[model samples]
Target: MEPINLDKIAFQITLHGGNSKDLAYDALKAAKEGDFDKAENLLEEADKEFNEGHKVHSKALRSDDKENRIVPTLLLLHAKDHLMAARSEITLIKELIELHKKID
Candidate 1:
């Protein structure tokens, strides 16, 4: 539970979460442009990034269990926030993509 290691994991979570969010937005943009194939590809990419972030978050949680206690930290919380926001955005973007396709 070195501080530096925790910081690294936190930063990784944030980075992957941001990447997922960005990919979802790109998917939405493609959908708006009526490029369904591209949109689907982008969405898949987003899913992959989200999974990566989730894995990091899971590892952090497991690490805490091994340490026998939870250490509350702002960076960890921020990373969790980013993960949540990315998940929400991806869900909404998926629904919007479906609606846009129907409209098209």
Candidate 2:
């Protein structure tokens, strides 16, 4: 396999991550308001975006050694922030759905 350039991969990952975060936020909003189908669709879209970032991440992992890790970049920090938000949204949505189920 060809090695991924750290700089280029980081840019792509960051964009996808940011988009995924937005989708996740929307998903959670829809879920909270009992729009389960819309919420599910939004979550699926977010997962697709997350998977794109995961692709870049997997490439980085494939290309890097412990001693050769890429330097920290703002893009990476932004990506991490988005990833954190998305993960949080997924967890919160799951809980919200369960609570809704109980209420119904």
Q: For every model shown, what is its TM-score relative to the native structure?
A: 0.92, 0.70
- lDDT tens readout by residue for model 1, 1-104: 45337778888999999999999999999999999999999999999999999999897777776555667589989998998899999999999999999999
Regions more than 4 Å wrong, model 1: 1-4, 66-70
Q: Write the per-residue lDDT of candidate 2 for residues 1-104, one digit (tens) a residue.
A: 56446667777787787788788778767867888888789888888998888887776766676657667677666766766676666667667766765675
For candidate 1, the 10 contiguous residues with the lowest summed lDDT are 63-72
Clashing residue pairs in candidate 2 (N, C-alpha, C atoms within 3 angstroms): none
* lDDT, candidates in the order shown: 0.91, 0.74
Number of the predicted model whose lDDT against the real structure is largest = 1
Highest TM-score scorer? 1
User: What is candidate 2's TM-score against the reference?
Assistant: 0.70
lDDT of 2: 0.74
